[model samples]
Target: MDVPVLETERLIMRSFRAEDFGPMSAFFADERSFYYGGPLSAGDAWRRLAAYAGHWVLNGYGEWALEEKESGAFVGFCGPWKPGDMPEPEIAWALLPEHYGKGFAFEAARRALRHVYETLNWPTVMSLIEPGNAASIRLAERLGATAERKMEIYGREAVVYRHLPPDLLKEQFA
Candidate 1:
């Protein structure tokens, strides 16, 4: 399935592209990528980038590459990802450090949750955050998620934050 594009007032969420490789590689290689299980080698980054594209092909729904609308910069990724038996479909986001302070993550995430809750009409969605990632935990809270529990995902212990349902999201954001 072709990836669909989503837009907010300041950002455009679209499919990953080959040109995204360099930035993606840099992102994965950076020490800041630690919370995300990154700091990957170039080859690992390539395979990971390939997986992002393949995810769309296999699932018909997955992460969207976030672009700044004004400059068309590749900021990061945000969308729904459910890698088989994941307990639940997860609304995820990862932005380069340069884009961190801006509201891009929140704006993009609001749209992503909308896609999952309203478009896909899923009842509940989650954000799996590493316990040590203070930034992401705060972001998840701002996105109206609450830490439901701690569980092992892919052999690593992480906190699972439950996002509000569509109706509640509407009321919260309205």
Candidate 2:
């Protein structure tokens, strides 16, 4: 499946491109980005971008580069992905530190969730967030996700949050 461009009120979520390298590198260089994605050097960021592009070919769906609509600036990335060790589908997002607290992450994430549920027709999606990542936890909660489990991932203790399909949520939580 060809990756499609997604839009939100003030952002565009699109596939990765070579030009995104610089901004992507800058985002990764920030300590906050590593808070969840793990630390990456500039070279690693380029390699990661290449891998992200390949994910589209290998899995048919992958992360989308988040860009600001007004400034046309690359903010970060948000989309669907199945990390190497993850057993189930997951939704992920990260934004430049400057964009934090601006609702960009939530807006981009909401669009990604809609695509996963409505377009991809996924029955359920999960987010594995570090216990100390309060901002991410709040965003997941706002999206109707509930704490499902707490487990170790890549040597870190993480909390798994699940967003059930609308019907299932009603049936199970009603």
**By TM-score, who's the top model here?**
1
Q: State the lDDT at 62 in candidate 1.
A: 93
lDDT string for model 1 (11-52, tens) is: 999999999999999999999998777999999998988888
Candidate 2 backbone collisions, by pair:
none
- On residues 1-174, what C-alpha lDDT tens digit does candidate 2 reach at each position? 567998999999998889999988887787877555656899998888898888888888888999899999988888888856788878988888888888998888888887887778888889888989998999889778899999998888888899767576455434
With a 3 Å backbone cut-off (N, CA, C), the pairs that clash in candidate 1 are none
What are the lDDT figures for the candidates, one per model?
A: 0.90, 0.84
TM-score of each: 0.97, 0.91
